[model samples]
Target chain A: MAAPVRNHVWVGTETGILKGINLVKKQAANYTDVSSVTRDQEVNAMCWGDPQESEILMGCKDGTVKVYSAEKSKFTEFHDCRGGEGVFRGLGVVDNAIITCVESGLLKVWQEGASDSLELQVGAGVQKMRHCDAHRQKVGTGGKENDLKIWDLQKPEEPIFRAKNLRNDWLDLRVPVWIRDLDFIPDSDKIVTCTSYHQIRVYDPSSPQRRPVLEAMYGEDPLTALSITPDGRSVVVGNSHGNIAVIDLRKGSVLCTLKGCAGSPRSIQCHKSMPLVASCGLDRFLRVHHLNDKELLHKVYLKSRLNSLLLTSRDKWEEEERVAPVDQDVKDEEDEVWDGMETVEEKTATKRQAVTREPDADGVVKVPSSKKQKKKKKVA
Target chain B: MPHIIYSAWGSTCPAARPPGSVNNSCKYSDAPAEGHGAPGPSLEQDVLLPPTFSVSEIKNKQRHHYMFLKLKQDRRREKLALKKKRKKERVALGDKAPPKPVPKTIENQREHDETTETDEFAPYFNKQTTPKILITTSDRPRGRTVKFTEQLSSIIPNSQVYYRRGLALKKIIPQCIARDFTDLIVLNEDRKVPNGLILSHLPDGPTAHFKMSNVRLRKEMKRKGKDPTEHQPEVILNNFTTRLGHSIGRMFASLVPHEPQFTGRQVATFHNQWDYIFFRFHRYLFKSEKRVGIQELGPRFTLKLRSLQKGTFDSKYGEYEWVHKRHEMDTSRRKFHL
Candidate 1:
């Protein structure tokens, strides 16, 4: 197995295979034993276990959370949380405790070496649950007919904020509520969400109004996944038709649409600081696109339908290039030879500078000599 | 000045030859080369002819028709002479002639798809399970669709046809799973014509939706064979090279019984060309050591895949493995998905 530091993206597939992709090397490797895996163990959600990203916690379809250690390149632990009725929708970690939410809306917090776990029922038909990066204890839950609700882990009895449904439409019929995915905007109290009805909405919990402050529509198909940009001014949303568009959060307008995806995207995640976004889905290909130019940078066929993806927060890609090559001493020796040759060029350059300065000094002396001769002629 | 006149004359030579002689354009092109090689009488003729001359520019229709007929007759004579020369050359080198070159086709020059490994059909290929298929149609299917399903059920072994009765597929899936059916097929109709097909593998699925067209019933065929037997038929899958193509081929393979009964001498073929799946059924007979014959068992149709979903029959919420986006995917004529 290659070093986990070299892999920039980790994808969970429907065939119960975990794939690690290195964009710089243009190689993808399956991290799981394909022969031993069954369809019942399909990976549904994944998240970094720690701030250093050395551990990954994957939630599977059979109500098991498996922890993969990047340093060891293998799975180190598995915890069976089987009270939920459906597959897990989200996974998170806070202070060495694991947070898991399932489709049937069973949210649980399991502490290390503890027999009893803190469980909460957010609602039924939960589509997604996302942890807020700005606050450790904050998490949001939403789904079909289930409005957005932010829960504080410390106070599990009541939600901190509950989003109200939109007003009746022009036909006087009730508007439907189906939140497919959501992410909390860093440095603010705003939570942005994409709905199954192709609507992107941002709600301000700090404001008195419980309704969404902004709403925008992209395409006609249902929006399946979304991720906030690093700057948090825009959000990237992918629909069921394999169309991904970056929409502005402030003015509620589309910025640009990313192309080259053939099937519906299951998961999309933007890089922490780079102008790049990685998405994988039913097409079985992991594609990385530049958010600024929307150019497809890398595409890797992982040979299975991808369910979720996790992009490494590491920003130093060139550092991995220097560490990847095994022949370090050979490179150092080559550098020494080049360094020795550079001094010879420096010596010739100094000699040429000295020769050029002597001519400038002679020209200065000749001008004064000519002036003196002209002065002598005027005196005569 | 001569170069300019030469180019103008070269452009006008083909149009000046005749109408309905497009295939003889190669022979006419050689005329300019012969003129350049032997420039005695041909040069004088070229100088006399107008540069912008064309048969369409003729003012009189009768004279134009007469010239066209004469040119056609002359080209036919030249073609016959060339064929005679080629036949004589072949006869001279009868035993030592080089093999004829093979023709190129879109299938032979197809772009390589990277995903061709076989993985998903292990259970079916391992002979662990027998095929039990349930064929149904869209709610309230009309004349042609009813007949088509009846013929399809007769062709496939251990299959039964049921009326939809307007039940939701999501509801029907659970009942079908409890009954231990291996596959579920639903035929869709539009304006009393069977136009769509949805094939979903049972228990765990990778459902495929196809656009169905050109359905011909047994009675409609000109000289079809008699009604098929109850015995299992041999299956033939052709040109399924790509990864998606392999998946589709496996799906079709699982539709029939694993063990073929050769005593029946019946075959069902699914041939893929230009991404369209052509299905044919036939009955074969061995006449002698070197002689064989085949009769068509009718109810043949063509299918083009529209979308393949990961799970069973949940179009609204299920994820698609591949979807045919006409404007985006069909940009190239040579590129094929299946």
Candidate 2:
């Protein structure tokens, strides 16, 4: 029986191209646009519509949301998000609604009919919006001059948590506010945000202070994207200089850096069960690395700069292991002594040539010794 | 009168009776003047007269409200009289012209369907001459602009260069049009750096404007030794700022022939043209770090379509013609002001 195929890592490119890589086979498939018009070709954001990740929700620069189904290998539906300004900065799926956010901080939750039932203004110039399935109803938003805000879509009249700006420095100067990417700590009220100032801050809503409880600085370059590891104790972050590293959540220390990336990373995602991390960026390469020792597992050159990616839950290595066939007609003959083979014609012919290594000085028929063979070769 | 005055002062005022009334004795105990060390020797029978201003006439002091009301009523009456006079005049004049009864249609009278209207310069299409482009920049062109124009002329076959110093666009455009120039490419400067570009086709036009940023030259490119002019360089237009911009950029890039060929003894090589056409097309997240870094979407190649036009673009021209075809493909022509 053939091995069951695992999940495919999907990447959305700036050219509105969708590329899927099957890690087991190390194969890539490209999906082109159905129309010749290039307006809707720049894919700005992407999200999985279903829990099993069979449906992909792609947001284009033209404010159109395209639903592509992996099962059918074609786009299932296209819905225009009318009045949505600027490129889509975030795309998410919550229950029966398709949630989208633009750079102008217009967040809309669309039902099946594409009518926005719940809409919100997260303030203008929003850079990133993050929604975790674990906390299905809540989302986090932040950007320039816009502090981190956590809102419950079900009750969005007021944010559930609003972060305050950190206190002025010792010299009494205002601190800059630019939150690039954020993630909700699984099963907890804690949130981690990586900023353009190269700072990773952890905010606990349950705490007394409204500011981040733990603050630590990473590299000098601004961080662009981050994803929480499976265990939820560490976060893997990627910066504008194509530097990706893991940080310990408890101590906020740099754990290890993953190498071989050159341009700014656009997205970083870690699988829920596997020790694999998938990242893609302006370098136009999709890279998967093992979290254990940071060994680069697979690298695929996508034709365009990638904006976002989705790592499905299925493990290809496990399926490959299970389907690896076994050979049975083998014999262990390396150390076998064949005494009956000496009388065989073919065996004696080969043995006589091998045994006639050097003629002795006395012309006596004796087995060739190491010293005598060396001495005979020297004399010749 | 004094008793009436005391009663009118109300019970809350201990001074209502001038400290002579026994009924107010308890309220006067806290008075510091008569208590402790101060001596109060003089006691005179003082008579309080009526106040100079009448207390019951505050309502009479508010005269401005009624005056304003009267003024408003007078203005309304005057306006009504003027309107009646105007109406009478209009009725008398109605028989003469009737004001070209407003052209009733779906569109406003001022806005002709500009995209669908046929341009006046269609006769130039039959000439079959290669496009002659005039490349120039704003007054006092920067060093970068001059260098870019030199590089640009070498890419596009018969393009010429000029500086708009001490000359207006109105003067230059007409002169170029009269001189048989097919198109004009203008680089606008901000702080002595080229930041915006305008490409207008000759005579009549569907001009395109683009925001140019992150200008990198061949010397700035990472890979060296490969002459930028050697190969027919592939153009990459990365991350256009708008959807319409993306569509227009793609339309422009598609004009270049896929394979270069020599029609006679001449072969035109498009070299550093891609660099000028492919400006950094990205939205900066923070204004402070503007143009420092980019979230490059992907490589996108763009060309100035107007600068390549042989004849004026008419939306009502041939169906297969790019002018009308692109106008149809891009539904948001209103945004790009096409």
Candidates' chain B TM-scores in the order shown: 0.65, 0.38
Alpha-carbon shift of residue A234 in model 1 (angstroms)? 1.8
Write one digit per residue (lDDT tens) for candidate 2, span A112-173: 76543678999988989888678789899998889999999989899989999999999999
| Candidate with best lDDT | 1
Q: Write model 2 residue lDDT over B1-338, tens digit each, in one string.
A: 43343333323233322334544433333343243344643333111212222223325444435434544665587678778987787888888734645667764545533223123223333234346788888888877767766665655556788877778776787788899886777877788666767666666653555566665544454422223232332344444544234434433443232333322112222212422344432212343744443333221223343322223332111011122223332456343312
- Tens digits of per-residue lDDT, candidate 1, B1-338, equal 43333334344665444344334334445555666677475555576444455445656788667656655776798788778988888889998877766889997688754333435556787677788999999999999999999999999999999999999999999999899888999999999999999999987898999999999999999888899999899999999988799899999999999999999999999999999999999999999999999999988999999998877888886767788988877999999998
Give the fraction of true interface contacts kept by model 1. Answer: 0.41
Chain B, model 2, TM-score against the native? 0.38
Clashing pairs in 1: none
TM-score of each: 0.72, 0.49
DockQ of 1: 0.17
Query: Tens digit of lDDT per residue, candidate 1, span A49-139?
Result: 9886788899999999999988678999999878878999999999989999999999999999998999999999999999988799999
